[model samples]
Each structure stands twice: as structure tokens, then as C-alpha cells.
Target: MLEPAEASPGTQAEQASFQGIRRICGFIAENFREDIDCVDIAVSADIHPKYAMSVFKRSTGMSLGEYVSLMRVSYAQALLMRDDASILQVAMDSGFGSVSAFNKCFRKKAGMTPSEFKREHRAAPPPLHA
Candidate 1:
């Protein structure tokens, strides 16, 4: 998975714009641990929320809200992989205010509850010391 910073450069202006958008996306992904909304992403991207949503959707083929949700769910998937956190905690930490909302969105986007996701991708324990 290439971090936004890892994207290749292009023509000067194109590269600058691409880097700008990548920085905005990276900021959102990083701050996703906090309460992030379309307005926040818009401000980060230096555009009106409506315009940001439009351009972001056109560029990514998903609405800004949907993209944020996917990013949140993706982060939750990582936490679930550890098998050390509760689903509710994962929801809260991933920016979901309520478990029901989290479950609904998770099922809609991921086709499974957080618990099911965790079970499916549970990491193996470390080998015991001899």
C-alpha cells in the first residue's frame, strides 16, 4: 500500500496538484482517528465542501463521505486484525459515534459485522518461547 507521499511525480503543475490532493487525503487518513467531516476534508483540500465533494467523487469515483467511511472501516479492519479490541471500541476509535451505526455501515460496505471481520482476519499468535 503506497502512502500518498509515495506517489510518482509528473509534469510540474500536474505533480503539484496531485501532491496537493495526496496531502489532503493523507491528512484525512491520519486525522481519521478524530472527528472528521466533509467540511474538514474540504478545508484541508482548500475547496468548498460541495466542490470538494464533487471533485473528490469525480477523482476517486466515490463521494467524500463514502471515502471517509471506507477509510474509517479500513482502519477498523486493522484494529480488528489485532483481536485485542472490542467492536464498540473499534467503532468509537474509528470515528463512529454509535455501535449500531458502525455495524450498519460496516455491513453495508464490508458485508460483515466488526466481529465477523475480526474472526475472518484474526492474526496468529506469536510463537511461544522454547
Candidate 2:
């Protein structure tokens, strides 16, 4: 069950806190392709890093670093789907400092190396029937 905003001070504070979390998450999603950090996100949300981290963890059940890693891996997945990008380029574009680190993380998250993932996805057959 959920309480209405007008029901109590606690409810109102909860609502405001939820909104703040959403703003922070949205900012991260939008800028995840860039080199970003907890401080950057906290500044964008007009909150302190420690407070932002606490709020984000409460709402997302993950730390800001975990969220960023997931976002970066997701972006890499999208880039890997494209034929125009090399794995190294995708790594750099997704804000990883080095290809080895990117490959390690990609393997951890996607269960394969970036090159293998890209090749498998790129080689998939399209549906024949409409």
C-alpha cells in the first residue's frame, strides 16, 4: 500500500526524496557515455556526494559505481551491435580507460569478450518471414 502525499510529513519527504533519486538516475542515464563520477552526478543533482550516494543506494539498491558500470556495459553492448565500431573504440567511447579493462568487465557482464560478442550478434540471421 502507498500513502498519499498529503497524508503526512513523512509521505511528503519520501516523495521529495524519490524525485531526487529519479533526477540523479536520469542524469546518469543521459550522460553515462561520458567520463562521469559520483561527484559529477551529485553536483548535477545539487546534492553532496555522500548524501547522493545514500539516496541512490536506497532507491536503486546499488552503489553509484555499480550503476555506472552497468550503464557503461549497456552502452558497450549497443556499440558492439554496430559494425562501424572496433572493440577498442567502443571501450574508449564508453569511458573505459583501457581496452583490457573494458574486455574484462565486458566478459564479466556479458559472459564473453567484446569481439566475440560483437561477432556473434553481428552474424545473427534476420527473420525470413514477415
Candidate 3:
């Protein structure tokens, strides 16, 4: 499946514009672990903060904070599903500053607490075939 920009446009300007946003998105994905703000992200993306926020929101349909939280919650959810990493480990590794924040976001996004998610989603051992 193609992204909207990839599927709908082939113009050079469109491609360039898309690339700029992609660069920003990539930076966010890579560095959301650290404390990152819109200004820092904008600097990494080589654009002004206000413009970056506007562009990002327009392109992605969410504010930068929302996107970062979404990304963190998503990564944390994946770790939780594995059921090996501790909740605190998942929180830190997934870029949350604290367990409380991670839990709040996880519940908002997944409709369950992190521990509950892990417990419920943990895969059962394969049936022991004789």
C-alpha cells in the first residue's frame, strides 16, 4: 500500500515537500527516546518550529506532542506484548519519562493498563502435542 503522497503525486515539488516531512518523521522516530521538543525537532528537520508544527499537523493530522505520545505508546505496547521486559523498562526504553505517563498513554490508546495489556496479550505456549 502506498502513502497518499506516493500514490497521488509524482511532481518534483511534491516529492521534495514530502521528503522534508519524512526527514522530520524519521528524526522523531529515532530520537523520541530522548527529551525532544518541537523546536528541537524543527531544528533537526531544518525548519522553523511554528512552520514545522503546522506542516506536521497538516500532513499527519496530529500535533507533534500527540505524535510523540502515540509513538511512545506504540513502542511500549510492542514491548509489553513480548511480556519479557518489565513495565519500567518498557517505559524508559519506549521514551516515557515515567511509569505513570506511560500507563496513562497506554490506557488512552489501548483501552487497558500496560500490565493488563501484557497479561491479556501474552501468547499461550503451543499445545503440547504428545
Candidate closest to the true structure, highest lDDT? 2
Candidate 2 lDDT over residue span 1-130, tens digit each: 6548346888787777787788888999898878889999999888899989998898889999889888899999988998788988999999788999899888988899999989888745667996
What is the C-alpha lDDT profile of model 1 across 21-103, one tens digit per residue? 68668878888778888888878877678877766676788887788788899998988898678998999999998999899
User: What TM-score goes with each of the models?
Assistant: 0.78, 0.84, 0.83
lDDT, model 2, position 16: 74
Better structure of 1 and 3 per TM-score: 3
Report, for all candidates in order, the number of backbone clashes.
0, 0, 0
Ranking by TM-score: 2, 3, 1
lDDT for each candidate structure = 0.81, 0.87, 0.85
lDDT for residue 92 in candidate 2, whole number 0-100: 93
Order the candidates by lDDT, highest first — what do you get?
A: 2, 3, 1
Model 3 lowest lDDT segment of ten? 4-13
Q: Write the per-residue lDDT of candidate 3 for residues 1-130, one digit (tens) a residue.
A: 6765566545655666677789889999999888899999889878889988987888889999988888888888788778477999999998988999988988998899999989988867779889
Whole-model alpha-carbon lDDT for candidate 1: 0.81
* Candidate 3 TM-score, C-alpha based: 0.83
CA deviation > 4 Å runs, candidate 1: 1-20, 128-130
Model 1 Cα displacement at 92 (Å)? 1.0
